[model samples]
Target: MTGWTEYTLALVAFTASHFVPRIGDLRGRLIGRVGRRAYFSVYGLLSLALLVWVIVAAGRAPFVEVWPQAPWMRWAPNLLMPLAAVLIVNGIGIAQPFTLGGRRQAVFDPADPGFAAISRHPLFLALALWSLAHLVPNGDLAHVILFGLFAALALAAIPIFDARAQAHFGPDTAPAFFRATGLFSLAPLANRSWRKRNGGRLVKRTAIGIILWAALLLGHTAVIGVSPLP
Candidate 1:
């Protein structure tokens, strides 16, 4: 249907919008033109607009079934969602040199790297979890496109981040950072208790995550007109 076409366009636009801007000097040039703060402000607003369009278009697209919804499907998010949220909260809450403007903060420890004890790229991990958690139960063409794209991009980012780190931090610091961090679930390497070091932030962010997830549970029907709860 016509909505399928719209959904496809929206998906393509969403991917291109984020990627194209950052390809070369385009983003830097834009930042120079508009000033960094204004550029980010505009970028944020534009990205939000694109996201809304994708969601709206996906909602309207005629359902093209893939697999029949499994009875056990809803449980996937229930189990993994909190972990994803926690990772994201812990990841971004710290100053990660990989993120935009974060290198300026100089918070990435060659020794610890905070939650990088679990994974060097916790934000990417969180995103992949979030994408896959929602995508599996979705089982529709439009949503498959949307969430699959995100999951692929997030997973791909892990390696990309590593490469960027090596380049940016140089041969010495980067190698030590990589040695300290694990590609996945390196909690075994954690030298001390993370809970002790960042207990307050952990409690606060997890509580906020719970509140947000609860709101999504209650309001998914209202917002998307589909009950996430089976």
Candidate 2:
């Protein structure tokens, strides 16, 4: 198959991998059979593999320029990625069960909602940020298609996840969860109620985010064959 064909297939497979399991009780049935740990391990590996394929295929696809590359384009990812890294650092394995990356065993406290207070779907927001930032620099048909799908999916997932959570938690408990969380907002940082609760964890996560951002910037050329620096 041609590069574009491969890229298309990879994108379809990646999308399906995320959506198919959510159809009816397929995910629950799989978890029942293999146990949650094994099911998620396999699912994670598959998703990672598909994501790498889509990325590589996009590079291989014919570069049809949609817009001229500019030095300013490179600044988008550089500026946004640190925030994305921090969101990933804090959102992963967190107690918020309202969205993706929440730990099943952890209990979510509505009063002290932590990062969820800033965004209930922090990981998805991070994914959207990463996608949009990269999209600004690429300015090519293949990569535009690639990053556009991711950005759209990440944004769309927030409401879908919220609806699902509301359904799962029912009318009583869902109000408190919804009240404490925002879809994506920086106003929480300025708000005294949320500011007092987030405290040390925010600092710790930001430190980790800075380290991760530095590592990614350093490795960008090695991994992607292009320097992220403008």
Candidate 3:
């Protein structure tokens, strides 16, 4: 198959793996039939396979440069990646867990929102920032498409999930959960409530994030064959 064709299939599989199971009664049906553990096992492996395929195919695809390599822009990834990692850790918890185990947000009171007051969809922000961080530095056609698709998906998921939440939890409830939250700055940093609420957690998270960032910095060359540190 052609590089474009392989890339297209990889992209489709990645997107479908995320959506097809959750959007409809499909997830329930599978769980009922196979049991949640088995279903999750199958689903997890499939998703991982598709993700690996995407990475491999994207790397192998025709490298048409979209922009001249600017090593100066390497700083962007360094900054953005750590921030992205932090957001990812914070995002997939409390109200919005990304994994199958934390799928149900019903037990968790949405009213308290916690970190979600920063952004209704921190995972989306993480994914988008992660994509953009790499997208800018890579400067190749396949990578541009790969990261661009992910960023677009991340952006699209915000409103889509919001609308779904409204439909699931009633119109008033969804809006209420997001009262102080936003896509970016629905909750301003200057707000005393925001500062008071997130302060301690932010400090702890920063410590963890720095460790993660350092590992990434040191591992970048070994993993991606590129040096991200200055």
Model 1 regions lying over 4 Å from their true place:
100-104, 184-195
Cα lDDT of model 3 by residue, 65-164, tens digit: 9987787877778878888877766665545442222345334355455666666677678889989988888889999888999889888877777776
Using lDDT as the measure, the top candidate is 2
Instruction: Note the Cα lDDT for every prediction shown.
Output: 0.76, 0.90, 0.74
lDDT per residue (tens digit) for residues 1-230 in model 2:
99889988999899999889989989999999999999999999999999999999999998899998899999999999999999999888877876889887767788887888877888999999999999999999999999999999999988888898889779999999888888777877887877777767888888998899999999999999999998
Better of 2 and 3 by lDDT: 2
- Local error of candidate 3 at residue 208 (angstroms): 2.2
Error of 3 at 136 (Å): 0.9
Model 1, range 12-88, lDDT digits (tens) per residue?
Answer: 89889988997887999999899978997798899889988998998899998877789689887777877776666
* Backbone clashes under 3 angstroms, per model: 0, 0, 0
Model 2, position 91: C-alpha lDDT score: 87
CA shift at 178, candidate 3, in angstroms?
1.9
Position 228, candidate 3: lDDT: 80
Q: How many backbone clashes does candidate 2 have?
A: 0
